[model samples]
Target: MTVDRGVDVRDDSGFTLMELLVAMMLIGGVLLGLAAVQTSALVTTAQTRQRTLGTAVTNQVMEELRALPWNTLNKGLHASFASAAGGDPNVDGARLRPPVEPMIDEVLVTSTTQATDKAPLSGSGGTNVTATSNPEAPGIVFTSRSYVTRPAAGGESLALTVITTWRANQTADERHVLMRSTAYAPSGGCGDPNNQPYLGACQALFSASAGGTAPQTTITAAFGGETTDPEVDATTPILPGTDITVATMRGGQTGVGVTAQQSTAVESSALHAAGSLTAAGAPSASASTGGEAVENQASNDVGSEGAAPTDPSPVTSNGVAGSLAIDGGDLRMVITPGSGSQAKVSASTVTKCTAALPAGVPCAASDLASAVASTTTLSVGATNLQLVRVASSSITGWGARFAGVAGVAATGCSTVSGPGCVAAGASRSVGAVQLGSASWSGGAASSGLIQVTSYSDSTRVERGLSQRTAAPVTARSGSLRYWNGSAYTTVSITGSTSVTASTGTVTWTGGGYTVRATGQVAVTPVTDLASAPDPAGCTGEGCSISTETGTVSLSVHYRVEGPSGVSAFVTTTTLGAARAAAGFKAAPGA
Candidate 1:
């Protein structure tokens, strides 16, 4: 062997077929294993990133809620959460990019002041642990506490729980997450009558008549006494009274009564027998006797024996006519016939009307004064009276509804049949009218507080906004709908959109469009990593790729508060996985 058999150097250059096969198989197996491992790692990493995002979103919502005012938090006007990443938007169901817009996955919100019976706990914090023994969950949750008391006091506990879920890779073994929020307030938050905070009087009155009618009334009669009808004749210079009756009565004072005097006859025959008698059988009456004669004669007979008269009795008259004759006060009368009798009488009905004029030239006290004091030159026009600078206060109690011309003034008199200072050819409506004046010649109609005037008039100047009718976009209800310049126009979805109306208010919906998720982040993965061989192979450490991803599902629940505002809540989590080492041990003998 010492024979220079130089290191038996055979062709160590190439591998044998069997060896090659073995190598290929081993490498293939290794590659397959690495791929599997890398795929899992990447998936896990993605899950974790998603979970973190979900958690951040949830926390953001909670923080927002926390910063709200106590009342607002308790009320929780608009608080919600949503996933930032959206699902595939391609209608064909193709895998798209990380969704540019977040797919509304889940949503949580608090719109009503009070929560439903199934609401979660009442607090700013929430638990995620599902195990009963866990004390609280680690997932998003909300809690609330409140106190309630009857007239006699008491209280109870309240909590809320909301959960969301979504499909990951379209697997049946779906993932799901939960979140909850709570609020605490007085138990009787609902203003139901039974649960009302306090009770009100709610009283009613009752009487023998009308069966408890709303309004009540009473009737009274007045008696005419001796004050107006006295014994004095038309020419008799008489004293005020005989001091026979008392005008008024005090608590203990007695009322007065009248007594008639007994008549004494001075017979002419007696006078003749006495020696002082005229030939015509007249009695020689002394001054005192003359006065006595007047007293003996009946001046007025209030009550006497005679045939029944056809005149109506005042007592029956008042009773049957439904009239209450009052004395020493202003009396209110209705022109209509009273309850029983058919009698015609012009009567005044008393009503507590407001100071404003109810109708016509019969001006209210305030308007009357305005008409008199207004700076208008009184000029009787040919046909119509023109009121110039006079202001109209007939509508609002605050002040005048219109301003008169500057140079000219109100020139109407009380003789005008219409309003004391009204314009001619003006249309009238409830609470207001349409008129034309030298100042308001713009074909304007006045409202309670607003004035609709034309912009055509160049000569007549006025200090008011001008209005005119415009054509309608479409017509309905027989009449051609018109826009009063300030009304209806074309509306655009995302453009200069506006709603106008001549008579009604304008409303818009879905003003601010946004998408949110309603499901919970059941599982979340934070990180994942994988390694592969590189060139210069002596089984060296390989290059590695790290990634993060997560999945979350949402419940189908959402709400819109107003045209431009909406809210939602979504569940989220974090997940991660990474290889600590990756390599290939050298084959025993290369």
Candidate 2:
């Protein structure tokens, strides 16, 4: 029964081709949207990167222009622009070039046109625009214009404009970025090669006014509406015609002529009287002119090399009458009041030093004091350090010499800690007196020699004295008599001695002898009257005696005779006579 059920089996279900196509289309559409988003993100990132590079390039160019010679700038010439190209291996996007190159972006310079009144439509109409070619690089255009401004306080100004433009990728969209900048240069003269070409013929205009003639013009162009005379009015904004012809007269005059207005009621002759016909056919002067010429004359008058006017006080910025102070020639020092009424120095404060003092050194004490007292930064001049005292607890080399002086001393001073005095330190030399007591350590001699005088007694001798510690010592012996309150004591010796002291001379013989003193009276059995005191005991006559048979210790009693007198006695007996010579005496009762 199961085998017979498969008899009518056939395929009935299947996917339609249109449905598959629709699914694929949906997938493709989603992929396309993602691609568009990726492309936009990439474009935005590239633009941001390009903008950063552009800023860097701008800075680099500005620095280069600042360093370029004025004459090079004056020539209205520059290096050629170079462009670079590259591509990614994967996407093959647009190529990128170094932005520093002038051609990194296309630049166009357009000089604004000068309008005039000759043809009412001439100046009012866009005209007088000029373009020149770069002589060095023919392919490049020198679109920047050179225009001269009217006289300024110091001099005239010449302006130049630099313009740059960049284009986006062609396939993506039509878009552009443009930047323009104008700069004015200043200098004393244009002839200096390093400073020349700051501005072209504009610089010469100042010299021309000062009696110098203008050079002949090489380039010239004439506009159809340009007339010899042009009308000037409050409403005229620019000169007539896009291009105006300019001529240079041989006699140093520059005249401009424009075609007179044909249907205008205002006559062309009135243009000259109205001060409207300028060389460029533009307005001759600014409208807000208020005593400016008078002010310039006053400045010139004040700068003139002569005594200023006694009266007619000059008006200052605050509308106050300004007065000038007269300076007394070289002898007087000028004083200026600083912040908070502190004493300060001004340009006029210098005084000429003429004569020198005989003895004392003259220092600018006031100047030094002022510098240290200033609330602002203390600017130290040579005079500011004139009276600075250097001091230290210790020093080396020449500073030590100054430290040994009698009165003067070095003070320790530093940039940070200010200054300090070392009063305890001695000095080698003072104002007039030289110190005689300075000595060196380790037995070395001081910078100065030792000084001595016999006016002091011999007892006042001094030995080694240390300069560092200022103390007397005995290591090196030398005679010195320093000031004492009382009379000097003599340190002298009478005997053989290395160092002298007050005493008798020390006598020594080749062979030693024993000295002895006998009794004043000898013991005699019932001694006769003939017995007497031994003269040997006459110690009062300056003698000493020893008693031992071999080597004996001698007892020397130095009987110093009193200031009054001295006496001695002896016996007449023979034995007594022998003993009397030995310097001993008998007992008192005997």
Candidate number of the best TM-score? 2
Candidate 1 achieves a global lDDT of 0.20
Give the Å error, residue 533, model 2.
Answer: 99
Q: 1-590, model 2: which lDDT tens digit per residue?
A: 46655577789977799999999999999999999999999978866655554444434444444344543333332111111012111111222122323333212222223223211111223221123332333333222111111222323342222222233443443222223333345443323445433433221000000001111111122111224323333332221221112211110111111110111000000000000112344333222101111110101123346522212222211111111111211111111111111111110001211121111111010000111111001011111100011110110000000111222212111111101101111011001101111221222222111112111100000000111111111011112221121222222211111321121112111112111111111111110011112333211221212110011000111111112111111111110000000111211211
Q: Residue 218 error for model 2, in Å?
A: 80
Model 2: lowest-lDDT 10 consecutive positions: 266-275
Cα lDDT, all candidates = 0.20, 0.20
- TM for candidate 2 is 0.22
* Model 1 spans with C-alpha error above 4 angstroms: 1-14, 64-157, 160-164, 168-174, 185-590
lDDT of 1 by residue, 314-361 (tens): 110111211111111111111111122111111011111122212111
Each prediction's TM-score against the native?
0.18, 0.22
Residue 373: error of model 1 in Å? 87
lDDT of 2 at 142: 24
